[model samples]
Structures are given as C-alpha cells and as structure tokens.
Target: MTAVRPWDAFTSAEAEVRAMVADPRWQGLSLHDRAHVLAVRILVTPDGDRWLFGAHARWHLHDPADGRWHPAPPPRGTRARQGRHPSAELPLDVIPDGPDFLAEPGSTQAFIGPDVSERLTEQLRVLLRAAGRKSELEYPLTAFGEIFASDVPSTVAAVWGAIMWCAYAPAFDGNERLITVFGEYLRRPLPGDEWVRWLPTPPLVDLVTLVTERARAGRSRAALRLAAVMADTAQILLSDTRFRPRALALLTMVEPVLREPTLDAGLDDDEAVRRAWLERCPARLCRALMGETDREAHFSHAVYDLVEALQFARDPRQAAATFLADLSDSRGALPARLDHRLRLAYEELDRAGLTGTSAGESTEPDGFPVPGRVLTMPAPVTEVAPPDRASAAAVLGAAYATGLAWGGLTGAKVPERGLAGQAALVRRLIHERDDDHF
Candidate 1:
C-alpha cells in the first residue's frame, strides 16, 4: 500500500487542531506550543476529516558509533525537498498573523483561518454522517460488550471512547439523524459468543510487573502515562454507583498499594492511571461474580438493584446514578442520547441480581447526584427560555467553564481567569440587554 503523503497528513493534522481549538472548552488553551499540540493530537481523531496543526519539538538523537546526531526520517515517505511533488501543494513556509490567511504545512508557523474551518467543517459533516450511518449498519451490541470485556490495550479503548463520544456528543450539532441511526447500531447484538471467548483476561499483575520493571529501568514517563490511564478508568467505574463494589474490589486487588494514600499519590497523570486501573478491572469483576452461575444474569441483577435504589431513593444518589436514570427515562435530556443503550444494559443488570453482595455486606459510597427535578417533572413556574444568541452563548460559556472546573481541568485558576474571561468579554461584545432578540 502507498503511504499517505506528508502534505495530506499536514492538512489533516491542521484541521484536527483547528476543530479542537474552536471548541469552547479549548478556547483558553495555547495551541501554538508543542506539548499542547501533542495533547490535542491524542484527543482528536486522525481520519480524513480530523486534522491537527501545530509544531512538534523535534530533537536529534546521537548515535554512539557516529559522532553526529541524525535526524529521524520524515515520518516515512515524506520528502524534505520543497516543490518536488505534485502532492506537495500546501504552502509549507508561510505564516500568517491574522484570521485572513490559512496555515501552510511544514511552515515554522501558521494559523488555520475561517476558510479552512468552513471547508473542514463541511467535509467532516459529510464524513461523520457517513460514519454514523456505517456504524449503525455494522457495529453490534455484542461487539460493544466485548469491547467492555476484552483485554484490548487501554490506549485502544481510550481511542474508542473518545471516538464514540465525539460522534454522539450534542456539542456538535447538525447530525441528529445520524446520531439516531448510530444509537440503533449500539442496540443490536453481534455475530456470536465465539468472539467473546477470545477475550483476554485482565492483565493487572502483568501491568504491575511492567510498571515496576520500567520504573527500575528509569523510563518513568511510560509508566506514569499507563498508571494514569488506569486510575482514570477506575475513577470512571467507581463513580458509577452500580459498579462501585466491583470497581472497589478490582482496584484494591490490582494496586494493593493504592489503599495507601502516598503510594498512589503520583497517579495524577489521568491517562496512565486509568490504564493501570483498568488492567485489573476484568479480574476484579470476575472475582466479584465468583459464586454466580450465569455471568449475564449476574450483570443484569447488579444493574437493576442500582437503578431501583436510584429510582426509589429519597436523597440524592451518585452522579452515575442520576446519569443512568436520566438515560433510561428522559432520553431527550441527555447530552449523548446514543449512550442510552449502555444505560439500558446497566438497568437490565440491576434486575439480574448481580448487584447483591454477600449477605449484609455494605458497598463503599460513591458521588452525590446533582440536585434538581428530573426533566420529566411538571414545571411549577412559567418556563422562560433565553431570548437571544448572546444570552444563549453566555449560558453555554458558563456551562463550559463550570464543566471544566468540575472535571479538575482548572487548578489554582479562578473562574474569572483565562477563557472564562474571554467568554465574558464575548458576552459583553454581543451585549443586548434592552431587546430580547440578539
């Protein structure tokens, strides 16, 4: 197969970066820096529609045998010579300061302006629609469940999660029909149980051994990243009240050291920690179901028990509970309604009795739910929707700020700082207090 050209990769990367920067959550982030750019690449999809534009801080590595440092090959097949190939059409050296000019790939600097954004958005809209349609036709429920159960590399799982989230999230509009179709795909069953039989068991011990070995060898970055991903995945599972007991058990067994605060203290790198945590998750789950005769039956029971608790509880429950309940009953209220199938699956889990622990055993507490009447609750007062685009933008801006803060992205940073400040400025710029229409 012919390698994809550097020019094409450059264009693709640029588009991905632009889309991320355009997002409200990323408005404050510095896209020009290499680290930020690399982070964005990890976050964004690299298919034709998505691209990232930013500089990579390249370093030359010296060979001990040779006195000189050699530059790595230009990402395989990419020729350094300018103007040599027909595909090398991008102006690789032009840097434009304003919104008027588009970025040239291989340039020292460039900004993707409005034209590129418009073009890429149109292209992505088409591609995303096509993907949503294809996913509806191809991906089966069993495949998704297998993904949950399989011992696939944590990186692959993270990519899958990000892809599904981006494809289904409400932040990007104009694809309601596609979202609906994809939702159907998630609900159907896969080809067979044979696929599941091949699932790899949790590699918790192996991961622990790897981390220990790597740390001994002084490759801390790899270990940290893996550990962070594991921790993050564990936190995600732990937050789900339905999965709390099993998650807790799995976490304890995988990283017995985590039970002590100091040993797990440096698990702050989100991705690595999540991976480390997930390495043990399957085994923990299996152990939890040790006495159960039917695995599916066990899962179903755990879900229903949790849902029942949520539905009948007098006080606020965990965020996961509220999220799950909203998923099962008020589909329209969810930001990603495509997740409804997963929610229903969990609800079925509750009915299956898998949630019941050994007699009289108490599970650890999870998070508290957001307080509010459910979306289906009857409105006691007249509902007054925001009147103008400015107001709408302000609301969204505030929500984004709040979400960032809640998710721990903003540390030691005040709400009045950074992009939140910019958003405030934009609100003032478009202020229309007198007339409701923006």
Candidate 2:
C-alpha cells in the first residue's frame, strides 16, 4: 500500500489505530470474518470518505477512492457530526461514489467525526481494495481531475446519482420516505456523461433478490415501494445510450412477470388490472422485439397483440380465433419463424375448441381489417396507463442500489442553480484542499 500520510496540520491516532486493527494476526483472517469483528467506530464524510476510530481513541481517515488510510484531524464542525455514521456491526451497504459536496459548510470537517467498531474499518479496507481492483473508476478525493473538472455539474450529479443507486442498493430497506426522496432526485435532469459509468447488472440482481424476499415475506408496501423506485430508475436507463443495453436487460428479466396476469390484491377493478397489464406489456414487448423487426414489422408483433387481446377479451378462445383469422390474412408474407409460431398457436386454439372457423375459412365479406395491430381491436374503451406490478419490478434491483446511495448521501443534495452553483461548490472544495495543504 502507498504511504502518503496527511500533512502535519492533520492530527490523527494513525499509529495506534494501525497497531490495533492492522495486526499481523488479523491479516490471516478472511475478509468476511474480519468484517464481523467489532472493533471500531466510523464517521462518514459529506464527500463520501470515512473516518475510522479504533482502540484507545486511535483514528484514521479512509479515502475510498484510493483504499488507503491517512492521519485525520479531530472532528470540529456540525457538518462532520451530521454526516452518516453507519454501525460498524451492520453489513456495509454504501459505496463512496460522489460529486464532492463542497458547497456544504464543514463538508471538509465532515470527514472526521464518527463511530464504528474495529474490524469494520479493516473490513472496509478489504472492500475498498477489492473495489479499486474491480472497478475502473478513479475518483478524486482532493482535486478535480481532467474528466470531472471539465464536466457540467448536472452531469456530475446524474452520474453520481446513478453510481450511488447502483452500488448501494443491497442495503436499502424499501422505506417510503427514502423512496420519496429518490423520486424527487429523479425529477432532476440526468444528462448522460461519457466519463462516469458503472454496470447496472450486479445491482439489478442484488435488488431483485431483495425484493423477491420482501414479497415472499408479505411486505406489500415495502415491495411496492422498491418496485416503484426501480421503475423510476428505468426512466434514466432508457434515455442514456450508456445505460440502454442494461435497461433492455432489465426488460428481459421482467418479461415473465408481465406475461402473468396482473395481481388483484392491491387493485380493485378487474378492468383496471387488464388495462394496466395491456398498457405495460405491449410497449415492453415492442422494445424487446425491436431487434426482430426485419422481415415484417406488423407480423413480428402479432404474438404480443394476441397476448393483449387474449388478456382483454371475455372469452380467450373466441379472442384467439379472431386473432388467428387476422393472422391468416397475412400468413403468406410472415417470417418463417413467425409463421411457424402462428401455426402452432392456431393448432393450440383449435385443439381447445376456441376457434370459430378453420384456419382456411374465408373472412366475412365486409370485415373491416383490424388496422395497426391489436391495439385497434373492436374495443372503444380507453384507459390510462399507470405503474403496475411488472412495470415497477422491471428495474427493482437497480433502483434499490441508487435509493440507498441517496439515503446515505442525504447530507449532499445536488445544487439546483446549474453550472454556477456547481462551479461554486468546486471552488469551495479547491479552496479547502489548497488552504489545508502545508
């Protein structure tokens, strides 16, 4: 490890801390076991660094960016005390991803006050070291690098938000207040940036697993809130090129959930449930099928329309017959695979006695061709589309990560005044860093 200690102005119990928590004997323990050792108290900084206190009041500053500890000055201000100090005993959940909160007073001091157990600091060292190895990110702790120095504040905020959400989701408890806070953050503009990036897949998996557990435990409100946050996150993933592929992956994961009938537990009206199901499934199916639209655009989506129609009709068998007749009219021009699936679908319906006529039967002489797919199928009713089960659950995993990040960084709200506000924050950080240097 590098040994760049802080300037003499910074007071710390670094030597004592190292001797206590970094013992050679401790080195033999696995990271997981070391994490559970209760030995230090922690203080989190507004900018996302951590202050670790070990035995005999020994303390060190941990820069998550470098996975290194430095001598730290004692806590001196309100901001330092207000910053999050997660229990050393609880499982570590937050990632130290950040757009420095230099605008907040005492944000500098926010790096020093804290409470946590001993092995926890050691566990964090292990985590930060692992993170440094695995992630391509090289965040700045004391200076603005080329990428961040030139970027706009909004981009910084958005990227920071995305990283925090994706990284810290495993610790999210699905609280409604936190969900509201996340929703408000989402309302801010999230322009994409090339410089800052992270994989959405791992967090997505982590979140989905958590939500599945919550749902299994019958925590309906928590499950729904978690799902809502994920859906909210999808709005960001869909708009950014960097995140679109992961967004598509999210859609694929949730497709089965969409295919199932909408739950009637929270929903009261059968019509409302069907309408909600129709609204979510079709658009998702279209996005998923975008890669398959080469031969016949209309025929490629025939199955989705059939699914929608079957979902809405009073008698699914009769609905299937009507859809097959529409399919039969265009059968000659259909893609071979689509033609094959359609044939199988027709036979499946025929076997169930759901078809009104054989596949080759002629259409009614005055039959108005069902124009523009199943959306125009003989119904005149219109229903508003709202978030439902599958739509919310689609991005659940990612949402939880981002949500926890937000909760952890509750002290560092992004400025609303655009570049001027961000410029000011950066200036403060620079001023603080330069002023503190020997």
Candidate 3:
C-alpha cells in the first residue's frame, strides 16, 4: 500500500479515490458506492458557492504514510459555524444523507460552483492513484471543467429552470413569466467565446429531458413551452459548429410530440397546422447542420430519415404522407432527400397517362410538365418543335397576350406597355365591373 501524506491528501481527491480503490478495504465496493464516496468527498469541499458554510469542518482523510485513514483538520482559514442553517447552505447539501443526490433545487449548486473546482484537481489526483479508476475519474473532472468554464449566470438560470420544472412542484406560480424571461435570454446573441461555447449543450439537454418526462407524464403546456425554448435555443446555438449535431439530435427526438395527430385538432386546418410544426424542424436542422465542416455530410440526414419513414408508414401514414406531398407540391422538391420518392410519384403519374410523355421518354427537364391548356400566361403563337427554345418563348408570349386580353389588359383604352399602364387599366375595369351588372 502506498503511503498517503497531507500534501497528497489535499492535492487530489481523485488520486486519493484511486488509492482507496486499490486498497483491500475498497476492493469489494460497487461502482455506485465508489461514485457515492467520490461525490460525497466532492460535496464536502468548499466549492459550490451557493450557500456559505464557514470553512474548517473536520473530515476523514486517508494517510499514505501508514496506509490507514486519519482525522484531518480542515484547511487553514476554515472555521465551522455553530448555528448555520444546513438546509440553506450550499456545498453541504451536495453530499446529502443518501448515496445518490436528489434532483432538488439546491443540489446543482454543489456540482457547478467554484468550491468544486478547488477540490476537483485534488479529487482527480486521488482517483488516479488506483486501478480501474481512470474512466470514472475523468467523468467528474470533465464535468468540473465544464462547470468552471461555463457562463455562471446563464448556467445557473438554466440549472434553476431544470430544478424548478423537474424536481420542485408548484414550479413558481409565475412560471410562464419566468419562461418568457428565459426565452428572451435564449434569443439574444451570445459571444463566440469559450464560456458561451459550452453554455448550450448541458442546459439544452437538461431542458429537453425534463420537458420530455413531464410531457410523457401529461403536462402538455409545460412540454410545449419547454419545446419552444429548446427550439429557440437551438436556433441560437446552430451557429456554433461544435454543438449543432447534438442539438439536432435532441430536436429530432422531440419532433414526434410536436407532430402528434391529436395536437392538430386545435389548429385552423390540418395542413396548415402540420406544415407549421414541420417547417421549424427542417429550418432548425438545416441551419444547424449547414456549413459545419464536421457535420456537413449528415446535413440532410434527418430529412432523409423522415422521408424514408413516411414512405414505409403502416398506420396513420396519411399525416406523414400528406406532409411530404404538400412539401413537394409547394416547394418543387423535397428539401433534403435525393428525390427518389419524387421520381416514383412522377412515374406513377406518367403510368396513369396524366402526363402526355411516356416514362421512357425525356418528357420534361426535371419537374412535372406544365399543363397544356391552363391558359398559360403567355400563349405560343405557333406550334413549337421539340427543344425549340425560340419557338417556346414565342408560344409563352402569345399565352401571356391571350391571358391579358381575357382579363381586358389590352382591350382597355389606357396605355398598354408597362406595369403602371396595366395597373391603370385593371383599376378602371374593376370600378366598371363593380358598377355594372356583371
């Protein structure tokens, strides 16, 4: 057994943890127990600044010299107060009476505050001293690094929001107001610094998880609001290359809830409702994935996944089918996918003889052929041969003339060339038509 000294004990708790793990006494302890002990030691430190418990509380420290545990006095400048309210204190609550910390409001403070940082360096040292401790040691150290590197104010608010919604009930009577404030903060542009860079990932994941759990448990409004906040934050963070992929993954996970069929009953129309819900999904996904050097290859992966799922839907496929169909109809092509389904749809149309061109021929360049008798805005003056560009232009011009004449654009006495002249004629006609019988 290695000898443990006061310097070694105070320098790295993680090192001490590793030494303990290697010790015969700790060999039988489960990983959870190990984590619990590490967490308790972490909480006992003076980090996590939320509630101030005066420094200098006596605690056990393992002595390396004799390979045995010893009573260590608290570090210098530390003095315990007699009447401090333990509940209101900060770091102390982090090491609660139980093994696992509850998702209580005050608990996060211990994990995120300054006191933890001081002890983490020491903790890591201790954990590194033992076998099979490297992996576990790194986890809390990384967390400590993230906490220390985070924007304290924003992180605190986000953590507080998570606690409010998840751990505490009656989450503030003015929860809506609080949400609005946080939403505004989310909308604000953050700087492209290390602190802001780490800001979104942890908080966003926490919010999404909390909202999903609540929504699953039947809190619809809270879930919706949480999702909205998530979407908004995602929009802001999409600019950051490092965080986009994970953000997109979380957004995709919650998309089904937003698109739930039952959620559509309150909308103005089914199509409008569905489009509004889906539009944001792609916009946010695209915005986040586009131009990302690491993630560019998977930029359209989400859209393709949704398309494939829609094509194979076994039940209530109508909703997904209708969404893709409307997108194709209005947008000319599926925004992300490679257009396999589009080709199939066109082939089906051609097979039905709706399109004059055979499937075997190159009837149209890329999209569906324009209808022949739709009173094309500019009618052709003569029969156009195949691929006759000039002739096609003339035909279109004639169609435009015919449309104009049918609408009285040329027949009116007003000037006839420019848009201004056409507008004057249309205005006179509108007054005359309304004044007249028909």
Candidate 4:
C-alpha cells in the first residue's frame, strides 16, 4: 500500500490553507524561519476568519497588514508550549476558544476536536422532557429504560442518536447515554434460559480474567478492546451484587491504560486536574472502545478530557482557579451551542449531587478533594485463568446482534462472516468497536 502524505491526507483543506497564506496581502512579509508548518487552523470569529499557522512550538497569526509572524495571545494560565499533550496537534486550552472548525475526519493535522453534538443533545433532551412530564416517571434509569424498550420511531431515533454520542465520547457522562444503552441492554426483559445462554455461568469473570491477562502481557490495545466488551456490559457488572467484584477486578486491569502515556497524551496535563482523577473508570472503559489511530475519536477524546476536567472542579468558582481561569475569554469565542453544552454538563453534575465542596472541608493531598467514593485500584494477581471461549463467543454474539439492529436502522452495510466464520468476524471488528463506518 502506498503511504498517505500528510498534506495529501486533506487535499482541499490544504489547498484552502495554502491559498490563504499565498494571498498578495502577505507579499510585504520577510520570513527567514526555515521550519515547516506542521499544522494549519482557521479561527472563525464574528469579525471574520483569522488564519493561524503552527510551527516551531508556537502559533503565528497571519497579519494581512504587515505579514509578520506575530504571536497569538497565549492560552489562559499557561506559558507558550507548556502543558500541551505530547501528540496534540494544538494546545487543549486553545481548542474551545472559537467556533467549531471542520476537521477532515482522518487527518492527523485536523484542526478541531469533537464538540458535543448539538443534534444529539437536542434529541436526547426532548426524550428526557417527555419522560419527566409525569411526576411518577423517575428520570435517567426509568426514563432510559422506557426509551430503550420503546419501538416508537422517534424514540428509536433518539436512542440511536444517543448511541452515536456515546460512541463518540464513549462515556461523555457518568450517567448519560453510556448508562442508558448498557443499562437498558442489561435490564431488557429476557427469558431465564436466554440470559443463561448469553452470559457465562460465572457472569463475565472468565472474560475479565482474559482481559486482565492481556493487560499483564502488555497487549494493551487488545486488552482495551476486550475490556470494552465488559464496558458495554458494565450495567450488569457494576450493578449486580453477583458480579461487582469482577467489575472491580476489570477496573483494576484497565486503570493503567487510563494513565498510559499514549492515552494521557489526549488528556489535560494540568497538575490540579490530573490529581483530581479526571479520567474515571467508566470514562476510560468506554473510551477504549474507540479506534486506535482514528483522528475523529482522538479529537472526541480531547473534548471528553475537557468535560472530565470540568467535572473535577467542585463548582464553577473552583474551576476558575485553574483550567477556567480564562473562562470569560474562552467563552467569548465559543459558539453559542457549544457554550450551552458546557452549561448542560454543569446542570447534570449538579442534579446528580456530584458537584460542590463543603465549607471548611480540608482538601486532600492533591488540594482537590474528590467529591464521591473512590474505588481503590486493586493489586495485580499472579494466577491465570484460561479464557472460556464459549463466553467470549456469546459476548461477541450479543455485540453482533446490537450491530445488526443499528445496521437495520441506518440501512448501512455491515461486515459479514467470512470463511473463518464467527471468529473471523470478531477479529475483523473487535478493534473498530465504536467506528460508525465499520
């Protein structure tokens, strides 16, 4: 296979950036900098578009008048090039600083990360509104169950929209679509025999062991994929008294993957946020479902990282201390819809009783006292249990069935079993678990 040149990866976008840079307005500029432009971004503001070229660890704004490579204002509370993720195309603080930019999904230099999907958010809110119209209808679990079980066309569409949202962030919220999908799947009415046939006798213990061993053997990516299966089934694993221990054990295995340098490269590097356990077990587990090298998912990871950071703060006042120090400036550039999303996150967290610090409460060593119970990360165990192939196959079958439902709704082509049959199908798709196109 021929390699894709970075410039060729997004031909039209590159052409547009090139055209902007080559305009006669920049003719008077004298440039001696030999460094190649590694990334290109266009910030859309009410005044019009301002083009930015990133090179040599700094972003230079293109000035039409003088064409000098003048420094753009540094992001809030951070020095130039300091605290950026190792693989980040641009600084995290700068991402939420303007209206959302279009990214050509697969390009490494794509300028924007995924913002909260407005359509999905709107659709989901409508569903919640209907569910809450009656005082007897309890929100979240009861509402989610009703929606998931309904075959009503509009409700189904809402469910799929939420599913796409979750697949994007995998776990954008601790109690949103991620919980709805997996929780509904677990709570769906099924015959005793059907339940027995689908899950193993010991629930997901065998599969959990398989994932743990894979993590220990340094097959982190593969382990990540398997752990996602458990994540999808987490409503059962975490909620059921029978399997909570196994869920905790699975959590123990993938916790390191959360803090893995490669994964953390997509997260906030601010020590205050870092010390607050921004990436929790639920968030990381669902995130592992995303593609390894997918730019779309990587950007979504970046957005989710910010959401997690926002969650870390006890309140808006607390957030202003660090990541939100320049909130006023950042919000000025944020699109109205995107601004609404952040506000919604705050509302949801507040409703869950998850946000806020008590008066005069002493802070933890990290200076940020975690608001809720923190699950202890367990020590690694040495004994190995052979994976039950039967259980793995059953879980794959469940996942395949869900894929088929989605396929039926979208009328999109899905992968078929090849000559190697079920195993081949599993091998083909396990890596691309949350890839919509796949």
| Winner on TM-score (2 vs 3) | 2
What are the lDDT figures for the candidates, one per model? 0.29, 0.30, 0.28, 0.29
Candidate 1 lDDT, 1-438, residue by residue in tens: 999654544344446655544456553543244233443342122221111132221111123232222211112122222112121221221111222122111110001000113333333344434433322112222123444333323332332232222110012111223222233323233211210100122223433443443344454544444344444444444432323444454445345443442353365443454354444434314323321223332223233223222322232122123223212122222222212333343344345432211121111112211222122111122121233333333332222222222222212222211222122222222222222111
Superposing every Cα of model 4 onto the true structure, what RMSD results? 23.5
Greater TM-score among 1 and 4 belongs to: 4
TM-scores of the models, in the order given: 0.20, 0.19, 0.18, 0.21
lDDT of 3 by residue, 5-103 (tens): 544323354345445544666547654554455544432334311111111112322222332222222232322222222232223312222211111
Q: How many clashes show up per model? A: 45, 14, 34, 0
- lDDT of the structure predicted as candidate 1: 0.29
Number of the predicted model whose lDDT against the real structure is largest: 2
What's model 1's lDDT at 291? Answer: 17
lDDT string for model 2 (1-438, tens) is 999864431133234433435465654765454444422335554556566543222234454444444333333231442234434433332111111111111100111111112333233333333322321122111111222332222212223233233221221111212112222224332221211111121222233433343444565444443344444444444543323433443444444443442242455443443343334433323322222222132222223333332333343323333343222222332223232323444555445544332122211123422222222221122121112222211122222222222222222221221111111112122211211211
Candidate 4 lDDT tens digits, 49-166: 2433332122333344433333232222221221112223333322211111221121111001122234444444454444334222111121233324442222222233223322
Which candidate would rank higher by TM-score, 1 or 2?
Answer: 1
**Clashes, model 1:** 45
Better candidate by lDDT, 3 or 4: 4
